[model samples]
Target chain A: MKYVLSFNLNGLPVDTLVKATDTLLDVLREKLNVVSPKRGCDNGDCGACTVLVNGEPVRACLTIGLTVAGKNVQTVEGLQQDGKLHPLQRAFHEHYAAQCGFCTPGMLIAAKALLDKNPKPTREQIVEGISGNLCRCGTYVEVVEAIQAVAAGKYKE
Target chain B: MAEYVGQPVLRYDGIGHVTARTRYVDDIQLPGMLYIKVLTSPVHKGIIRHLDTSAAERMPGVAGVITAKDVPGKNAYGLIPDQPVFTPEHIRYKGERIAAVAAVDEDTAMEALEKIKLDIEEQEPVFDPFKAMEPGAPLVRPEGNVWEFNSGKTRKIRFGDVEKGFAEADVIVEGTYTTATNDHAPMEPQVSVAYIDETDRLAIYTVSQDLYFHLGMLTAIFNLPMNKIRYIGGTVGGGFGSKNDIHCDHVAGLMALKIRKPVKYRHTRREETAYTTKRGPWTFYFKDGVKKDGRIIARYVKTVHDTGGYAGMGPYVVDKNSILVAGPYAIPNVWVDGICVFTNKPPCSSMRGFGIINGTAADQLQTARVAEAIGKDPWEVHFINAWREGDLGATQFKVEAAGLIEAMKRAAELAGIELPAHLKAMSSRGR
Candidate 1:
């Protein structure tokens, strides 16, 4: 039996049937074709599948597709408004923060949640913010720098 | 040289993953694709005398059940081909591939896992590498180690005589360092999807670092020419070194060949950790001799690498690790040796930073000891003796663009982090 689900995703209203077993990650990946939220550990140990749920960071892999029935879901794709990339995204690019990039979408979404809550966070706060996401590349030094860059207005162009 | 070798540049792979547009192997779903699930031995070591797949073959949406008999020519494939695709006689490892079931849905393929039955004679397995090499150590492979000399337990890098140089030293320090096996734990686990293209040839998509290496192994395992196999590498979750081992991709391709339909195999997290491998545990011994003025006179290093269950990049990484174990120092004499040994642990291989991180951890910790004996600052000692751009490494060959010192100093200045006083206590005899 097909079920109907209506929700707003990345600023657009999406009405779709979410299989009871399917995860919000599956919908974002399969139905919406948004591939950024990678299916990492899938069990939620590694935060590669994080997204903005009600403007807060949540692990998409853990969320049942039906649970996000009528709520706001923001993915890495919706970070930028208009024709410009977000300041945080620009900082990541400038600071060489991302290597391997497998965990970037989750890192971006996680950082966005932190920034939205506290526009100006200390370096330590930024580290604690994205600590949920793991990078095998050992680029934590640069990742911290990139986030601080955004907070410092180093990304203002 | 490019204008930005050391300069910070955004990773090219960053844009796609950040934008949520990068495609992984499991991300692709073909129009008419089937999924495969393999049933591995529950026991550690056994002789598979029989296999019955009749019930599984008759299930709805079941394509076929493939075993060792299905593999045509060369029934084995690996960096070393001793590991058979399907075991006809004995199972080498725990999850030694015995049989696979292909069906219309993954759940069906998974559900049919219990249907396949096997007859086996269990044997006492040797999980320890050291004991395995001893007189009565039950031979894991029996025919010596799987990695031959080129891939075996030995590497050599020598310079001036070590004994004579050590004889001139006023102080000497030697210690062994051991690190546990850590998983690459790539966010995206291993997944493989194989299908027949318009030409009816196999097209395999997987997460891999080197596509050419995949082509070579797949060609051997599947008995298909390079043209028949098209391997596509997309945004791998994180290969580290696990995906580089062509196990998942090959298994998926063989199933597709037998079923003649598109086959998809995505490993669950548990399956990923169970089926794949991790970086090997290593034991490194470093001996350094230095003059009273804090100048290193000679160095000797012996690295023993536990290759875990199989030899992936163990031998190659050991060789590199041994050289790096020598440390960033100007020494008059050096002799470094490395061995890649097989163990029962999950197949060990490479991780981020390759051998450098592991090797540096051992050597840098040793150098501060040398600095202690001479009563000199570790930083001053490192700066004075650190290799310059054109300085020769252990070999006579010069190393260009060696930024060891510059990078270290610049990092210190930027972070306002001088060598922490606590690091000096690392080599102290008493706690």
Candidate 2:
């Protein structure tokens, strides 16, 4: 049995058919054609499928599709606005924080969530903010620096 | 050359990564594509008594079920061509592939896998390299548990006479070091999307690190010419030597050819961690003969690599390890014996530094022990024995552009360690 899943995605209302057992990641990638949130680990162990649901970071792989009905879902695809990259995106690129880019989408989303809540995050806070994400390339130092650059207003739009 | 050498240039795919526009193998979706799930061996070592996929083929939403019999050209494929695409009769490892099922979705494919019937006669499995090397051990392969190099059973490196060097030594230090297996665990798991293109050529998007090497292997497995297949790669999400082997491409390509549709095969995290080729465990025994003046006169190293199930890259890794197991030091007499043994775990292959890192770990520890035995500073010992530009390596290769002394000086400065004036004045020109 499939249900019509309607949610606000990247500031636009989108509707798609999904099953009860389908995860938000499945619906986004398979049904809605949103391929930003990767399917690294279907479990909650890896944060590669991270997205913002109702202004909070959550693992889309663990979240059931039906639970996010009528909610605002933001992915890395949503980080761009009016043909301009987000501050986090710009900082990540300028700082060379992404390698292989597998963990970049989830890391960017987690960083966006962190900066939205705390505009002026300390180094420790930045580390804790993106702790859920894992970069197998061992780019955590550069990622933290990128987040710090954004928080320090280096990439203010 | 200097313009871009020291600059902080951004990656070419940086924008795509940040903007979520990068397409990985898993992100690719084609019309009427099916998902793949494989049936693996349950026991570590076993002989397949029975295997039936008819029930799985009859399952609802199951598009196709493929077994060892479905392989058209050849079932064996690897660097050494020892591993089978699908285990036909004998199963050497626990997670060896037996069959695969393609269906409408992952759930359906997984459910269809449960329908397949399989029976195996279990056998006693050996996990330790030492135990496996013992006489009358359960054989992992028909030949034996040890990989035979061109010379003999071990990768041998003999330099100056070790007996005379050890005879002149004032102290002898011995230590044993062991390193556990490691998984690459790339952020993106092993995945492949295979489909027959409109040009009638088999197309596959893989996460392979060595695309051409795998392409050659895939051609042999698929029984097709080189131009008959289109191997698309690059944009890999962190390989770290893990993607050097054909993990999912051959299986997905086989299923696509059998089903005549686009098939996507992706390993779950558990599968990637448990079954994929690993760094292979290493056990090293080091014996160093040192003088009271902190000079390492003689070094003897015997290393055993536990290459599980198959000879993926174990022989090459042992050869590379044996050549440099004596470390960067200018030891006069060095003898290294690197042995590659087989166990009943997942086949171990390549990792970050191949096998040099493992050898270096043991060598560094032995160096520290040599320093302690002679009552000398480790740094002084290192500087005294550092390789010069014209020094002969263990394999008699002339060292060129040696920079160990300069590198150590810079490292000490960065690490906030002050070197004595005499030690600081040492140069690699004459060692």
Candidate 3:
């Protein structure tokens, strides 16, 4: 049995049919055609399917589709506004933080969630913020640097 | 010189990555595409007594079911062509593919897989390489468990007379080193999307590190000419030598041909960790003879690599490892014997640095032991025996453009270690 799921996605209203057992990741990728949140593990062990639900970081693979019925969900696609890249995106691109780009979407979303709460995070805080994400290419140092650059106001809008 | 030399240019695909526009293999979705799930062997070693897929084919939402007989051209495909696409009767390792089902969704396909009937008689399995090499060991294949090199069972490297060099040595150091198996565990799991294009050619979107290599193997598996298939790749989400083999492309291509629709086959994270090829375990036994003057006179290394189930790239990795197991030192007499043995586990293959990293690790430990036995600084021992421009390697390969001395000096400077004036004046151009 499928249910009509309505949610605010990337500042746009999205209505799609999803099963009661469908995960937010499945609905976003298969139904709504939002391919940013990757299906890496599907077990929440990997943070590749991370997204912001109600402005908080959560693993979309673990979140049920029906649970976020009226919540505002944000993906990497939502990081851009008015044809401009977000500061995190700009910093990641400029600092070469993404190698295979498999973990970039999750890392970016997690960083966004971190900086939104703490505008000027220390190095240790930045490490703690993106600890959920894992980069197979071992780009954690560069990712921290990119997040620090964003927090230091190097990539202002 | 190019104008961009030494320039800090951004990655070409950087923008697409950050903006979530890069399309990985899993991201490519076509209409009317069916999901694929495979039936694997549950036992480590077994002989299939019975296998029936009729019940699975009759399941609801099941589009098609393919077994070993459905493989048109060939059932065997690998770097050495020893592995089977679908195990026909004999199962060598756990998670070996027996059949696959294509359905409307992954759940339906998984359910269809449960409908398939399979009967197997489990056999005694060998997990240790040393035990597998014994005379009475259960064979992993029809052939023996040991890989046969062109010369013999071992990859032999003999440069000079080791007995004569060891006779003149003052101290002998021996050590045994072992390294565990490692998984690449790339962020994105193994995935493939296969469909017959409008031109009647089989097209596949893959995350393969070696496209042409897998394309050649896929043609043999599908029994089609090279021009009959279109292999699209180059958007890999971190391979790290794990994507060199044909993981899903062959199975997905076979199912697509059977069902006449686009099929997507992907390994779950559990599947990726449990069954995919890995960096095989290595055990190295090293014995070195060094003089009190910090010069290594003789070195002998015997290494055994556990290449589980099939000869994916084990022989090649062992050969590469044997040639470099003596390290970059300028030893006069070096003898290495590299053995590749098969066990009842997942087949081990390529990883980062092939097999040299394991060999280097063992050799460095042996070098440190040599230093401690002779009451000399490890750095002094390393600098005194470092390879020079005209030095001969273990396989008699001429050393060219050697820069070990300069590299060590720079490494020491960065590491904040002060070198003595005499040691700092050493150069790689000469001794």
Candidate 4:
């Protein structure tokens, strides 16, 4: 049986029918054609499927489709404003982070969630923020530097 | 002169990667696409007593089932023709592919795999390379446990008389070391999508290290013409030598041709870790003869490689291991033997270090032991025995542009190490 899920996605109302067994990641990627969220490990060990729901970061692979019926959902695709790159995205590019890019979307979403709560997070706090996401290319130093760059107002207007 | 040759430029795909726009094999979607799952062997060593696939074909949403018989032309494919696409008679190791089913979706496909009946009679399995080579051991391969090379044994490297060199030596060190098998553990698991394109040619999209190599293997396996298959793959999500092997491309292509629908196979993390190829384990026995003042005169090494199940690049790796058994040092008398033995486990293949890392580890340990015995700094010992520009290596190859002395000196300086006057003036030019 399929259920109709209606929610706000990236500041826009989205209505889609999804299977009961389908995950939020499946619905977003297959039905909605929003492919920013990845399926690094469907078991949720690697947080490549991380997405923002109601301004909080959660693993979309672990989140059920029906649970977010009336919630706010955000993905890496929603990070841009007026076709301009987000501060975190810009900082990631500048710092040479996101090698192989399998974990970039989830890393960006987790970073956005961290900055949303504490805009001026310390280096240690920034490290703690995106600790769930894993980049296998050993780009942890560059990723942390990118988040720290944003926190230090380097990417600000 | 090129301006950007030596520059630390940013990654070419950095922008696409950061923007979440790079495409992977899993991100592909097509019309009338079917998912596939391989039914692997559960027992390590076994004989196929009974096999049934009718139950899987009758399952809901089951499209097709392919076994060894379903292979169009050949059942074997690899660096050597020893590996089978589906083992029909005997199962060499656990997780060997026996059958594969395609269905409307992954859940249905996996359910179909559960419906297939497979009966295997377990046999004694061998896990050790040395134990496998013993007389009366259960042979993993049809010929024998020890893989033979053109020269008789797998590999044999010999030089000046080792007994004479050891007799003249004042100090000798003997040691044995073993290295464990390592998994590549790339972020992206092995996945592939196969379909016949508009031109009626088989097309495969996968994460492959070399497109031409996969093309050649698929051509030989499928008995298809060179123009019949199209391999499209360049970008990889951290292969690190794991994706060099043809993983799901051949099986997925066969299913696609049988059903005439795009077939997708995605290996889960568990399957990737438990079943796929990995770095081969090695056992090294080293005997080094050195002078009283910390100069290694002769070295003899015996290395045994555990080529699991099938000869998946193990022969080639053993050959390279034999060539590099002496490491970077300049030893006058050297004799090395590398043997590739078959064992009942996952097939071992290429990794970051083909086979040199294990030998280097053993060499470094022996160097330090020799230093300790002669009461000298390990760095000083390495500098003294390091290869010079014109020195003849154990393999009779002359070293050119030798930089070990300079590199060691620079590293010492970086680490704030102060070397004695006699050890500090070492050069790569003269012995």
Candidate 5:
């Protein structure tokens, strides 16, 4: 049965009928045409389909769409504000953290969640923050460096 | 030229990737696009007795059910055309495609696959390459386990007299080594979108390491003109040689043509791990003859590669192994034999080093063993026997600018290891 699922997406209120079985990833990518939350692995293991639900990072693939009915959903597409790239996004680009970029969206979201909580994160903390995301290109060194740069105020929010 | 050559340049697709705007195969959506799911064999080896797709065809959301009979042109396609597009008579390995369904949605396609009835008589599977080569072993293919080159023999390289070199050597070191099969394990699983364009040409958008190679494979399988198929591939998410295969391209193309709409086949993570080819495992035996002074006299390697299930680039892999078995060394006598043997695992294909990496590791390990036996430092022994200019390689190619000695010295310096004055004085040219 489909129910009216109302949620705040990128600070905008959205109302749509979503099936109970539909995942947040399906609702975002398939229904809303929001492609930032990539379906790297439908299972939550890869963390490629990560989005912020009520400011907490969650795997969109695993999160049921109905559960986010009254919550705020933020994706990688929401990162840029008024034609300005997010600090993490700029840091990622400058540090060359994304190679293939399949893992970047989720990596960026997870990094953003970490920074929002702790403004200054150490290298180890950054590693723990994005541990859910996996990059096959072996870009972890650069990813950690990019997150460090963001925390170090290399790119201001 | 030098300014750009040695400098780190930004990737052209970096911004697209960082901003989550990159269009990977799965990200592409066309109007009325259909999703595909395949029905594969569950056993390593089996004879298909019965297959009924009528029930799957009648399923509510399944648009089309495709079997081996639906292949318009050729049933087989590969580097060596041994693998069938869909297994008809016998299942070679578990996860071999038997049929596929085109449906309104991925869930419907998967559900349709479950409805397709299939019966198979299980057969004894040969898992080990060594056992596969043994007499009385079940054949993975009709032609037998070991692959025969155009010359009707396994790859072999012979440069000098093996017996004479060993007879003259002061020390001989021999060892057996084995390396496990490796998966490329790219972040993005195999995915492709195929549709007929306004020009009536089959357009395929997929992950590819080489567009031409993928195009060629598709053309061969579909028996279509080269100009008739348009291949669109620019961005790939970390192939590591795995994405070189036309994984879902041809299959998606076939479904798209039959359905007259865009069809996307995205392999699940489990399907990618279980079904995709891996780097072939190798069992290597190395024998090295060294003089008392640490100058290597001879090296011989007999490597057997486990070319799983089908001959998917196995011949080329074995040939590469034959060429680089001697490693970067100045050996007076060299003999190398690389054999590609079949097993019931997924067909192995290219990876980071192609085939030379495993052979080189075996050769180096044997070199270290030879150094240990003669009470010589491994680094010093390697320096003494390093291939310089004018050295004949395994394939009889004259080494014009070998820098093994210089590289070793530089590596030692970088590693903060203070080598002896004599070892440090080694050069690429004859010292």
Candidate 6:
């Protein structure tokens, strides 16, 4: 029932034995102590458990820990380089994007996935991209506006 | 006062969300902690005649099993304390807890859930608000007429004479609209971790907005002093009011105490949607009186909300929606009434926009219809009668947040228009 799995986590290689039924969320949170990717809904319906496996955003709660072998995974911690906040992090701060911050991790990962593919997304596209991620604060107006600003290269200036 | 007020500030937490570094309750991992799972009722209405927990207690890796009988101090705990912490008599909703199993690991706790047997009878439940409000319908709660009498803190507003205003109006419009329930869909379903820290106090970590509210509830349920419960609101996952003040935090505290170890509880998506409170699903009835001259004479709105099982802020939702029936129009005569009724469905209380979204949608939609009936364009009637900064509502409250005229004008302009024909005629008549 034990499987030795080795994968790069937040830019560092992590090798551990996990049960066949162990989820990537439990592995990262309980075993490795990289606790940013939360257990929002054990099912993938809520994007709160998103982390990058091979640079593509995936719900850690849905993935089995053993499936992460040999993949270069990334997390919120990897977004910052040497104590400097990521551009998205800075933008979110400047725009008052985080009210409660629980959805921030999953939203960030999803937004990062969108930006990685298309850095210049339209306002509509920004809304569509984040439709999977729901914010209860009704901050979508600010969230969408912030994303649009970042995509249009306005915030960069 | 002249400076820009509506200028958008980049939201404060936007980047923290996108960067994936936010800490939620489940994100906290205490050393040697345990996982807890509950055996909930399969039917919406049932009584726990006998709970056989021997199989679960004998299961390997099972630390302990706690049922409602085991709960010390307060056996009944709810937003109002009418419902028990664990229902011993009847299941009010589909997911009432019967027995809870705490294990050294989450897997074992889940396994123990399969071992519990609950015997009960299903009661014919009240499924609809409209029927539940009728005279012959089965009461959803034991307080037979509490719903009809209180209407769950319904809002009622009256101004001027509605009968005279309606009779003098050139056109009348009325219609019924309904909306469905929506989940806060917070990235985090409710998660709570509790344990006795090194200080020997019952320390708890939960994702919530009002830490003080949860702390008070914990104190009452645990019979422990306020200082005994240490709450660390690590990070809130988009509450949308789901985590505003959870009814489930007590479960976490109970599990940890029963097992005598740190315990964590998190709901799956199904549980999040079916059990935890949600918003939306409101039915609205709006009646309006308007003149052919493009002036609104009177407005009447009746909002009936589905509270969905528990209180869960349903009363507040009804009041909030009823209070907003006028929208932004200038109406000299207005009457707004609301009712919040309980049903067999899952609880839905607060969501984004509180009650304003439902009220606004109904108001705007009704205004649009009234304008059409009176030979006035929707935009013109809406723009001309929109409440201004100093204009008072029927409630005698001043709107200080906005310049309603500028907003209407700019919105009309963006949509590529100035004013409707009736308003144009009004302007020429004035000149």
Write down the worst ten-residue block by lDDT for model 4 chain B: B7-16
- The single-chain TM-score for chain B of candidate 3 is 0.99
> Candidate 6, residues B1-431: lDDT per residue as tens digits?
44548776564445555565555676677877888887877887655677789999999999888888767668664455555677666677888778788888767898998988777877878877888788877667776523443533457788887778899998888988788777777766778888987887888887777788767777877888987788888466667677765656788788777667988887877777777777847889988888888888888888888887777677777777767777876688988888778877776667777677987887778888887888767777776777756666887887666566566666767888857554434321111
The Cα RMSD of model 4 versus the native structure comes to 1.7
Q: What order do candidates take by lDDT, descending? A: 3, 2, 4, 5, 1, 6
TM-score of each: 0.84, 0.99, 0.99, 0.96, 0.97, 0.86
Q: Chain A TM-score of model 1 versus the true structure?
A: 0.95
Residues B1-431 of candidate 5: C-alpha lDDT, one tens digit per residue? 88899888887888888888898887888988889999999999989999999999999988898888878887887777778888888888999999989999998999999988999999999999989999999999888999998645578888889889999999888999998999888878999999999999899998988788767878877789899998898878778989866678878988877777888999988899899889999989988888999987888788999989998888898998889877788788988888899999999988887888988888778888888999989997888877888977878899997888888888888999999998877788885
- Maximum-lDDT candidate: 3
**Fnat measured on candidate 1:** 0.67
lDDT of 4 at B352: 80
Where model 4 places Cα greater than 4 Å from the true spot, the runs are: B1-6
DockQ of 6: 0.55
State residue A83's C-alpha deviation in candidate 5, in Å: 1.1
Q: Write the per-residue lDDT of candidate 5 for residues A18-87, one digit (tens) a residue.
A: 8899999999988888888888779989888989999999999999999998799999888999988998
Model 2 chain B: weakest 10-residue lDDT segment is B72-81
Interface DockQ of candidate 2: 0.89
- Name the runs in model 3 displaced over 4 angstroms: none
Runs with alpha carbons beyond 4 Å of true place in candidate 6:
A45-50, A54-58, A85-100, A103-157, B1-21, B75-79, B145-154, B388-392, B398-402, B420-431
Candidate 5 docks at the CAPRI level of medium
Instruction: Evaluate residue B173 in candidate 5 and report its C-alpha lDDT on the 0 to 100 scale.
Output: 88
Interface RMSD of each: 1.8, 0.7, 0.6, 1.3, 1.1, 3.1
Interface DockQ per candidate: 0.54, 0.89, 0.89, 0.69, 0.76, 0.55
Local distance difference test scores for all models: 0.77, 0.93, 0.94, 0.88, 0.88, 0.75
